[model samples]
Target: MENLKHKARKPLALSTIFLRYFMLLCGGMLLWLGLLIGTYLIATATGEILPANYVEKQIAAAKDILVSSPEIRPDQIPSLSDYALYTQEGQYVSGSLNREQAQKAWKAVASGSKGGIRGYYTVIQREQQQEVLLLSYSIVMNYRSEWLRTHLPNPELLGIILIVTGLLLQIALWSYLFGKKLAKKMKGLQSVIGKIQNQDLEFTVQSSGVHEIDTVLDSLDTMKNELKASLRQQWEEQQARREQISALAHDIKTPLTIIRGNAELLSETAQDEIQRDYNRYILTSSAQIERYARELIEISKTQEGLKLERVTIDTASLLEDIEELLRAAAVEKEIQVHMNAHNMPDFIAIDKDLFQRAILNVVMNAVEHTPIQGNITLTAEGKSDSVCFTVDDSGGGFTFADLREATKQFYMGDRSRSSGNHHGMGLYITQSIMLRHGGQLVLGNDEVLGGAKVTLEFPLS
Candidate 1:
């Protein structure tokens, strides 16, 4: 790509495209005019077109005959083409010329002009005659060229129409070719935009040959590379962070277990109420530390990856297993755990361990938030195409920020996991599990409980 960019031609201005179109149009018109004039000249040179003064010359050859035969009438003079007779004073006497032509011709004759509107006329007069003879013929061909079939009309006007039509066609063809090329390049540019928007950066960049379009494409190619590098770097950094957390969590569990074992031994020997209270605090704090370390490992595992081992199990059996875990988590806090399942399917296909773990995580999050001895409710219901499990806690409901962002990775609320700093992966992990199961996790406030409600929608297979 770097080499290609260097090889790319400098971009031409947009005005250049318009200029080319303008030149083609003007050039076509000039060509049309030249072709029309050239055709006429060729026809004239070959005598296919008559001379302008054809009738006038014929009239001159007949003048001596009319002068010698002085008794001939005004219309009987010899001529090869149309002519008109006029009184010496310029009043019409008539032959083939119409009133309009006779009037224009008389002016030409009187002024000694060789031509009238579209034809040439020559006047012949006798010394003793009462009328003047005007011979005239059209210079603009009133008939087709001699080489054309007699059935055809005059070539002059028809040639103009045909040439103009051809000019328009030529110009249209040029415009279409140019427009097609432009559209192809634009489509290439559009493809680049689409791929970048979708973050698909693994394809070759197609060159458009055009200097301007290729320049823009080259820049976009560079941008795509930069974005890919940034994304990969972020991914690598995230993987390292998760590995570090997982290692640290694993390291902590060994020492935590020793501390808990030592606390249990101290508890067995306590004799006074004050000494008993001190021993109870050590055991309880140790247990809490152990749970936090376990959570840290769970968080890293969730981010790294989890494989689903789906198995079919009865709904009642699944619920029974979850009940044991939930009550065990809440028993020490004196929190009341109410659970029920209604309208449930006979069985469901799911990864039993992961599914139960996700449910436990949600309950635990609620347990951490609820005041000691507070109430928590779990309900499961069968839908037309899904099984929904809802957990509602009678603790302060989700704040606005939590409602919007609680499921995002590592989004600890202002009050959430207050004792477990940097430990807010429970809901995120649950959501990830739900997604992997082709399901959804919905979070909202429970109006009845006046606390946070989490609904897990599991699509049934």
Candidate 2:
């Protein structure tokens, strides 16, 4: 916020830089036009206008002729044929004009020295000289004005064309330079944002050499550092928790094994049916407790993510293994467990052990929820970019509320639907495994099976 205030108080260099370039363009265009006009004038003066010494040469020739013919009168000078030659006093001794109007023409020509159609006059002194011949020439129209009128088109169209051309050139030049510069800087910033979005904080943020952009980059770098620290702390804490859970599960495993063994022995040796029933209950309960402990340890061990050792396994072989693993539990419950998969990949790259665990948990959850003689269908197939596994059981489908929270850790279902010692981490751990393998777990009601359906999708390598 303080930086924003400082920025507000400071001059905006971006606009200033653009405006400076624009001014330069305007000034440069004006100078170019001026130069073109100056060049045109010089060209016309040299190529179209009379020479500077034209009057001098004409006066010299006239004087020579007059000196050679002494009988020639001044009025009959015969030198001024189509031109008006005169003295400084405005007296004419030339042809093509009357004496009455010589003064007016002379005055007009003398007043317009640097403009109009008139040329300079020459004064020559003779050997027996009493008077001098003041000689000059004039054109029908002023060369400068004629040249401008001949070359220039409509004023309005000229202005419009010049303005449009300048704007187009400015746009082109600005795009080539300024636009490219901004895009390059912005693209670098975008890349940094993308990396941060991907949770990759291992890169450095480079300065853009622009003050405002550099400030933003500095803020992003600081945010990246803070996020990295926070994520590291979380990972460390989670690792510690996982290790503690694993140690606890290990410590309890031996006691649980001994208790289950003792109960089984009691059940076999007891004579009374009530006593045997009690022993059987203890045995089953101890076994369930041990299974829960093992599952807890396994889930905690891979809390962070699975370290997959991927291999190409045949789909048929994998399905067969799953069916065999769950066959005992399904038969005990009198549930019909069927495998229906076709149009699947021959081989898939997967961590066979982790994949098996995920499949087992999903199938076991279905088995626990399904009633006796219920149907459980497991399907696997290849999709466009992934392979999918679906487990659907013929039992009461999940409630809407359960559908939303069923995958959460330790979220057990209702008492009637939940299995003994089951705390609802099965789907959670399954989801974790699927995510670790770059897949997702989706839960819903199966239309065909009319029960809860769990779909696991894995991306193809």
Candidate 3:
């Protein structure tokens, strides 16, 4: 019984079951109506089959009583068989018995005042061969109450059973549907999560058409995209750092080897001049070591967020100082050093130390790359909005693509111009400094000089 209750509660298709029950209710009402009509018709036909003589005698006696008195009232009638009537003016008038009233009177006559099954009858009266005769018949009301009481189940019990069954069916159907849909959505989420757990970032979950579930999946997708981007950026940074370290090691190795060879030569030599030359070589090697260490420390500082301390510095004095420092190196390479500044402002806001370092690095790069007798021009052009500095070196020009990625940390062009220690951070730091000062660093092949050109644009005060 419990299982049956569960089944009823969980009917397979709700729409189909409701339609069936509705049809059953309509058919039951139609059948009940048909039974009522049939019972009424049968009762009427049975009344017609009753003896006519009985109805006639009762009707004649009622008519005679009504006629004998000029005034006849319903209450003063002599017999149950007599009929009475009242006029419209409230006077007593004579009347014959009607079908309905005679039916009640005949029940009293036949059952001695105990009504005959509480129904209607008819009476027919006639005077034949000087003898009065009556014919009476009755039509008992159809006892539908008795039929229902005997055959039908208790109405309250039946109603409760139907209600319980319907509720159980609906609950079962909804539960199954909910469980199935939930499982489907959960499975999809599980698959996506499993792929993510396995480090498969490319997997995407299909939307299940459920709003809440789809919203969660969309959020997961967004998180995955962000994670992928972060990982990719980290990987690129790691690769750049690795290349920088390798270049650093290579640059230090050559100087260390030279220093070691010079030390050994100094130990083996006895001549004063040879000893002196060895000492100079040792001094040069030591200076190179110190330079490398300083460069490494500067790079570390830059990486750790070096901030510029602004000060008013004379642009002309700054240019003069840089030219004096680089003149001997340019002379050795037979490179012409030209410092051209026309209409230059006297003072500009700058970090005197870091800005000098950044600019010197770019000048040194130009000097190292230019050939003998190459012209290296450093020009500063002052505009209303900004100050532009251009360093054009007469050397082999770079490709279009190489200019774009030249400022990237540790990025070197495919064509090697110098065998010297080049970590490729000089231009990168120059670009960084320019950006920090609300300016930009641009690089291209010089249109006229046919060499590399670097331009730094700084905002005016």
Per-model TM-score on C-alpha atoms: 0.67, 0.51, 0.45
lDDT for residue 117 in candidate 2, whole number 0-100: 22
The regions of model 2 sitting more than 4 angstroms off are 1-12, 48-167, 184-188, 202-222, 263-360, 367-395, 399-420, 428-442, 447-450, 454-461
**lDDT tens digits by residue: candidate 1, 1-461:** 34243435654555687588778888887887788789778987786765545555556677787656655564554333567777888898766779888898888777878885446665678557777877776654533343453655556667767876888788798789778868976897899899999989986677765667777888998898899999999999988879987998898888888888987888788369967765666675566567657766886888546667799999898898787667767876889999989899999999886787689778888888888899999999999999999999988889998999999877778863465734677888789789889999999989998888999998897
Stretch of 10 with least lDDT, candidate 1: 1-10
Error of 1 at 140 (Å): 4.3
Runs of candidate 3 exceeding 4 Å displacement: 1-303
Whose lDDT is greatest here? 1
Ten-residue stretch with the least lDDT total in model 3: 1-10
Candidate 1: how many backbone clashes?
0
Clashing pairs in 1: none
Clashes (backbone N, CA, C under 3 Å), per candidate, total 0, 0, 20
| The candidate that achieves the highest TM-score relative to the unseen native structure | 1
Residue 348: error of model 1 in Å?
Answer: 2.5
What does candidate 3 score on TM?
Answer: 0.45
Among residues 3 or more apart in sequence or in different chains, the pairs in candidate 2 whose N, CA or C atoms overlap within 3 Å are none
